[model samples]
Target: MTTTLDKRPPGAHARPTPPSKGRGFNLLRYNLLGGVAGWLWLVVVLLPIYWIVITSFKVQADYYATNPLAPPTNPTLDNYRFVLENDFVRYFINSVIVTVGAVGPAVLVSFMAAYAIVRGSAASRFLRGVNGLFLMGLAIPLQAVIIPIYLIIIKIQMYDTLGAIILPSLAFAIPLSVLVLSNFVRDVPKELFESMRMDGATEWGTLWRLAFPLTRPALVTVTIYQGLTVWNGFILPLILTQSPEQRTLPLALWSFQGQYTINIPAVLASVVLTTLPILTLYILGRRQLLSGLTAGFSK
Candidate 1:
């Protein structure tokens, strides 16, 4: 006791540890309010989807007779059959064409523009100006410009055609795509770009080999976002196309509703079918979409 030897390791000091909070105190800190809010929101969203699925399976009579949310006693494929038999296949194909046509070119052009803006904005006032133009486009709502767009489509003799829908959709899609893509492109390390240049890689070569690979999550995000916009696009298809043959899914769904006003089951069935492709696409690209969004926000 009088000559107590120092027992601690030479480099190790006795550090004070954080006092332990009991389980009750830890539990008190859990976000109960947030958890409750999230559950409420989940129910709000899923309830209608639940009703839609259940109602789609019911017969027209059963739709009126049974509870709206109840599963059908005799679930029939008749509603789906009815929808498919009514040139649903043609409208589906038209949607595919319009979505692909618009999204492909829009993404391609936006990617190139974004790459140029990020790479050249420092030295080029024009590139910076172009970026400003894109930012301004985000402020311009489609409704405000629809009249002008319609007039241009008429002037170009593209009105009442899928091309009319695709062109406007492509134009509208570009602003947001460039905005998202440019941020991702700018996040690439300047050192890596320098290394590429030192290795005699052209900007074009580096864009594809380096930037493209690194920024693929953003590309997928843009593609899916724009694709969904074009896919469920009601106003453009309605104004731009007049023929039944030119109708995309949203326009087709509207027409389907008008044609079968009393057949709620059939209407919901078409809604489900129309949504399937989009749902499939989202499922496929959801990971990339989330990662892209996270990366964007983090920066």
Candidate 2:
């Protein structure tokens, strides 16, 4: 009563199967959804920038009469001419000096200090406590210390001078710069330093010649970040400087608005002009900026 099943011969023809319709459908759906989402996100981010650029070109009548969303029928460069002619260029130069002066020193000092902390002998408890105290700077509000900072500036006779803005900006940028650079420096291979040291290279040589080259992206990132911070800063300039000649672009823009009295076209023009340099820097340094901000982290 045993039953045996017969197998087909090896050379027999086989039945055909249908294609994987479900998998193909899923992939197509995902791609379509992702495209829609990505487009929406891009529009969200770029809309304001688009509006600013458009507003900068429109005449006062066009700005008031036409739909803002519509393209300008009459675009003019006169606003840019006026801003450049009326001391905006001067304010821009002042801002450049302050930003460069602050960020350069801040980055330089932070690189050395942070590299030492990461590669040198482990910090002592006392040194550790002091470092902890510095972190308190990040927690403290700038407004809380504004009065004291102003008083100190006046006392030091730096008031109304570029130094007043540069010095405080440098001080504000230091703690976070150190914190970021320390972590990045810690990730640089110890063998690199050891190899250089064995060849009779001094610590200074190792830092500048070895560490700095590899850390360029991070440094550039920090420079851009802190530079923008200093460039846009208004309170310090407002408190420390009174003369129009000493004022930075943000202060200048404020004054321009006051003088123009609801002249929307001029206001928007100033806004566009004020934002241009930082925008240019971002475009130029964006790659390095991203790398520096995210270096030394797990993938």
Candidate 3:
């Protein structure tokens, strides 16, 4: 390599020093501080997960006698035994049915509605209004309309049935899902959609064959998000269903929390068990879930 040194005198501004810093900050120190904060956050987030898993295995007697954070000296299956005998599995099944039932229709209907809103907004004033309404729904707190929801269920004779939970959860899931999917759909290239039309493809044909494949990531994102919401839902299950068989996982936690006393280990076990499926779901779809959520922000 050949070297060419500047022949300018020492005080001749030195070619502006090439900015030995970016924006006048010490970048390495800033990055190290950020790394420390991130690790601290990881520890904070993992601590509860650790405690719940460890506590779930401890014998109820040993749980009280030993330090709260200590690993069980004699870890036993007794709590799992107790949970199963009391129909924890049935609770799991009921949650599955409710979650699947609610999320399926929610995702499907939301996709269709979002497609219509995004594609038709240019031609139809009404659909633009409809999209506005859905975005508006994001502001309505769930607690505010919950009383009306409960009353509607009672009037329809759906109270105490799984339908009571499914119907409302589906309704609430739609607004957010439509908002997300519509953004994803709208971001689709205009040329691609027009090319399908040029080939004599019907609107529905274009939707399934073209829009769907492109938006699959957003769909998976919505499914996992809505499924988690409906799976762990407590408020709807609490207010709508009364029978033990009707109970979802959150409501079923009462099986471990007695009126006067609580089985802490068993309760934690139920929590850990209930969360496992959702954790698995997130693990599988986490990439798509995160990407879909931030899909349009880049533009």
Candidate 4:
């Protein structure tokens, strides 16, 4: 037998071996408790949604006769038809208008204010004070100041108008929007700002070209959040507006429930209809919203 001479460097370390596949399997198996909890939570959340959708398709008689969780034997469109014929279109349009009007201005103003605060707070005391004010607003719940808001709306002669709803929504939206957006703006590296300045970019130009694109995820997050708040808003609409023509979806849904108190299927159908737009919006911006929220929280 011949001994082989060692053919290696004097002190080179050996590479560590990769993890075995079974190790990953063992780790997953150890997390069975978390997996079980997650599944249970998912079922809890989805069960109500499933019932709402199934019940919307049921007739009033079947809804009473069948199991609450059971699917309809003979689904009907009459409930949806009844809801639609009862000024659903008008309420939808009002919601759209209020949502767009309020969210647009709120996001725009908040974004600009956030950028300003991030870029200029070092040199400006007013901006710092404004930021503090915004943070303070977060602690002020809508319920606390709703009476003052109502009085102001009345004083301004905006009572019972869509403007009444839009103005307060805009005001309430700003505080949280500013908080979320300013954090995202702060996360941007100073080097980028310096580079833009060295290239002779004006503040406005830098804002629109650089910061705006980078902060789009944050914008989408804010937009979705504020839109949902405004869309599902009941109190403002309830207190500010009374006319059927001026009613938003939430208020309309309340009236619909009262009108069809005995018709459970129609009530459920109206609920489904009111929820669809919001659900669609969430679906569209879900990825951006999640990423934005993750980034916001991580920072």
Best by TM-score: 1
* CA RMSD, predictions in order: 3.9, 4.6, 3.4, 4.2
For all candidates in order, the CA lDDT equals: 0.93, 0.85, 0.88, 0.94
Query: Model 1 misses residue 8 by how many Å?
Result: 14
Runs in model 2 lying further than 4 Å from the true structure: 1-27, 121-130, 297-299
Point out the higher-scoring one by TM-score: 3 or 4: 4
TM-score of 2: 0.87
Cand. 3 TM to true fold: 0.89
- Give TM per candidate: 0.90, 0.87, 0.89, 0.90
Per-residue alpha-carbon lDDT of candidate 2 for residues 26-132, written as tens digits (9 for 90 to 100): 99999999999999999999998888888888887888899987788989988777777888878999999999999999999888878877775374665565456
Residues 237-286 of candidate 4: C-alpha lDDT, one tens digit per residue: 99999889999999999998998899988998999999999999999999
- The better candidate by TM-score, 1 or 3, is 1
**Residue pairs in collision within model 4:** none
Q: Which candidate do you rate higher for TM-score, 1 or 2?
A: 1
Ten-residue region with minimum lDDT total, candidate 1: 1-10
- Please, what are the lDDT tens digits per residue for candidate 1 over residues 190-273? 999999999999999999999999999999999999999999899999888887889998999999999899999999999999
The order by descending lDDT is: 4, 1, 3, 2
